[model samples]
Target chain A: MSGLQPCEILVVDDNPGDVRLIQESLKDGRVPNRIHAARDGEEALAFLRRQAPFESAPRPDLILLDLNMPKVGGLEVLRAIKASPEWKTIPTVILTTSMGNGDIKGCYEAQANAYLVKPTDLGTFSEMLSSIQSFWLTLATLPVG
Target chain B: MTQTPAPAISPITLHLLLGDLPGLATCLLGGGGQVLEWTEGAHALLGQGREEAVGRPIADLLRIPAESPLPLLGQRAETWSLLTRRDGSTFRAQLITLPVPEGHLLLMHPALGTPQPKEETVRELMELRQALDESAIVAITDAKGDITYANDRFCRISQYSREELLGKNHRIINSGYHPKAFFTNLWSSIARGHVWRGEIKNRAKDGSYYWVDTTIVPFLDASGRPWQYMSIRFEITERKRVEEALLEKQAELEERAAALARSNADLEQFAYVASHDLQEPLRMVSSFTELLAKRYKGRLDTDADEFIDFAMQGALRMQVMIQDLLAYARLSNTMEGTQRIHLEDALDAALANLSLAVKEAAPTIRRFPLPVVMGDLSHLTLLYQNLLANALKFRHPGRPLELTLGAEREGGHWRCSVKDNGIGFDPQYAERIFTIFQRLHSRAEYPGNGIGLAFCKKIVERHGGRIWVESTPNQGTTFLFTLPMDRSPS
Candidate 1:
């Protein structure tokens, strides 16, 4: 605990239930983390840019972006993040309900860190979130923020 | 009655009158039937000189039969008599005698039985010409292609009088619709003395267009060179108009069919997008209900627990049904990854996917050699997996499971079969089973969303094939499908 730093994670999704479930799943993970929720891609971009309401926000160490949402879509947000020199180092993983080959291929081609289909089973879903947290936050060497 | 003093008949005036009666033999005979004067026609018909023919007894020159005697003077008479020529040969003649003041005037027309008289032949020719002129648009052109004659029907159709058409070639009515090559070919054929037939579009005098079906016959002379050409034509403008209208309608129908196909494709795309989007909310419902059941199952009251359980089950089932609907829609939307693959490889992959069920069922499996086919490998794999899964799901509990997979070459395709000793359904439901969400058994008996067979049907059809099942209740089931053979050589 003394050596570890709190990991900041931004979750972009339209459904509040999914955000809450993801938060609950990662509550007891190996890495201590603070989760921020953005209801849409526009808000997610705004938060990443630290504009207005998010002026004092910390740069997220990782992002869990959903493919389908209101306003801008996850792919556009990913491209915007990757294109910006400041936010390009942030590891953005796509988490969505789609298992279509087109969506999978599109996310990878957009340089997503990882693409994961939202599992239907609650236990499997929680395990997936836990693994993502342990691997991206604790194990993988992400850029220092 | 002095007959107006009876103008003295001069020989020159009399000769001029007799010469005007061409193709007839005439002479003046005395009251005693003696030849008094003979015209050139008489000399020509009797093969004798006028000098010798005159002053001869008419009965000696003409062998007049006694039964058909000449009438009395001042009365005209006609009879068929035998005439003697200067050559001493006798021939039949139609003889007519007219009474005159001084003598009888005889007119003779040589008549041969098989060859008609000149007057009759001329009359028959006139009748034939009238019939042809009335029925057809007829025209005669000399070898130089200048119109020599135009019938009334031809003049009416061309809107030209005989004066305007004669000496004019067919170019006056040419519509310029046909290419130069068309006329060139026509002239070449007719010049060679061959009959030419074709449909021609001609322009009228009023600048209107007309179509004619024309046939041209060439008359060849002794040397086999065409001397003249006669063309017979029929008006076919109405038929050509009908044909053009039919062609236009056919083009319009083809355009409409293409538009319909485009609209149908758009609808299919919409269906795919709608079904795909439906799965998102369904996942939230299923995952949350499952989470609720997991987190607070024992902590809640029995009623609450039961309600949560029911919600969980309903959400889970709905999720699966939506996914199945998405897969069905996607089958039409995506048709990539087509390749030549071995059927045995596809079957082996399906067996590997069902490894757990296979181990549990412990079924005896038999496989025969399969042919290489053209298809999407993943789709074919899913097709086989679904069929085998159905067999395992509906296995008869009373007997050990036995399954067989085999294929046979059938013309341009391979007919493959999967036979299973299972709890077969009623034969009536054989067709219904391939429809989505159509189930014969309740969920308690067979746990399925009733999508496997439907998936198999879609996959089979996507590869340009057909799938059907044959089954008998309490007996066994056999599923047969056909796939087109690969066209590429090995």
Candidate 2:
């Protein structure tokens, strides 16, 4: 390990089981990373902006977003993130159960870094996370803000 | 009161008296009813002068018999007779015969109060009779509605001999399809000398039904009471049949359309509810089981690892199946989603969407110029993506994949085809392959829920086109579908 800082990943999902599954997958995978959680879109935005209770939250290197939530949806959060000059370059990956073309297109149009359909199988989900870890965190260069 | 008669005027003096009356034709007949003189009025009324009338037999000129009772009366007598004109046509005239010194002097004038001359009346009656015989089914009944005359046309249309119908009432052909009030209204109008016009359904002699457009006119007597009812009818059975058939077809079409709309609405709702509810639990099961496998793969036994893998694959496959079903159900809602789209643009979107697969297959795909079509752009994109992906997925083992995609105008639509040099199945399963979840090979060989072609078919059909396939085992497959041209040929 070339004395590099651990990668920070923020998982925003309304479903706690899905968030936990993702965290467990990341933990078991061979990746040096730290995982943060936001239960809904509102919390996701608050954490990203470091507002109120999240004032001391670290800026995430990557964001894994769920499309459906109680407040502002994944697309809206993506738009908000991309609209800000400071946060626009941060890679935001959409992880959604919706395989609809409109959802996929809308997420990309909002300037998401990538879109991934959440696999139903635990093994596939874990495999997808491992690939993401290797490709985005380990290999690919990212903007330092 | 008996009073003394005035002084008697001589017949010649009365002739002299009538000489000044305009349009009064006086012809003096000599012995044996022969013309003695033609007065000036006679020349004006008969178009014949004294030169033509004088010395001619008066009875012949007047179209009267010499044996008439008026000649035998031996005194002044007044009677009606037909007077011949120069044109050989006859007119009705009132003749007053006065016995004079040697013969009878007849004074002829226009018949009293008649609207038309006798010859014109005769011609009009004849024409009316001919018209009824050729075009109308006529029946004349006495004031009591008992049939007195049934013309040849009436007999033919009613399917009854004239002899059998001459004394029968109009009820003989009553079909009983109308209420009693219908006939009552008809009779009331005709009895009052007001013509009644309506349609009547009558039964023929062979028990078949016929329709007639009828007009019943009442002939009034001198006392202004109806003496006869003349009914003129025209057959309208064929026209009525066509109208009824058109109405029935319209009603059937409306009912079918309503049923289809209701079914479509129900399917949309079912798709929405099923997709939302079913995907939630499926996501959890699959995600967690996959996590279990990743976290404890080496720590668990081989059976445990295999069972976890099985559970994960089953849940994931079920999720795909549910998503496909949802897609099929959503097709019903896309009927109104149409626009003018370029086929090449849609294909481009599909190729871009399947970039990963296309890169992996490393296949040679040739695309030609495509025509513009009318349909939902997104749906068309999906259609092309699915078929292209299918071609890539089913590539023959140990052989390089090659694809040809192009479109050409066929009749009123563009017939587009995708030919692939991939593993082709038996032609017998061609129809089965398009059915939902019908797979030609094991899942291990090719991965699909067998809904792609069906989806393509639905999209094509929604745009008023059709889809078909041609293939041979171990060779290749070609999928052909059609999309209506932007505008039909003029």
Question: Candidate 1: DockQ?
Answer: 0.53
The model with the greatest TM-score is 1
Q: Candidate 1, residue B453: CA error in Å? A: 1.8
- Pull out the clashing pairs in model 1: none
- Residue B433 displacement in candidate 2 (angstroms): 2.3
DockQ winner: 1
Tell me the lDDT of model 2 at B237: 98
Stretches of candidate 2 above 4 Å error?
A: A1-145, B1-3, B7-132, B135-150, B155-209, B212-236, B331-336, B359-368, B395-404, B408-411, B488-490
For each model, chain A TM-score? 0.95, 0.95
Q: Mind giving the per-residue lDDT tens digits that candidate 2 earns over A1-145?
A: 2336777899999898988888877986666788889988899999988997889989888899999888788898999999999888878999998878999999888888999998766667778989888788878888667
Evaluated at residue B148, the lDDT of candidate 1 is 86
Task: Assign candidate 1 its CAPRI class.
Answer: medium
Q: Could you tell me the lDDT of residue A134 within candidate 1? A: 80
Separate DockQ for every predicted complex: 0.53, 0.44
- Assess candidate 2 and give its TM-score to the true structure: 0.57
Off by over 4 Å in 1: A1-5, A72-76, A79-86, A98-112, B1-267, B333-342, B364-369, B372-374, B408-412, B485-490
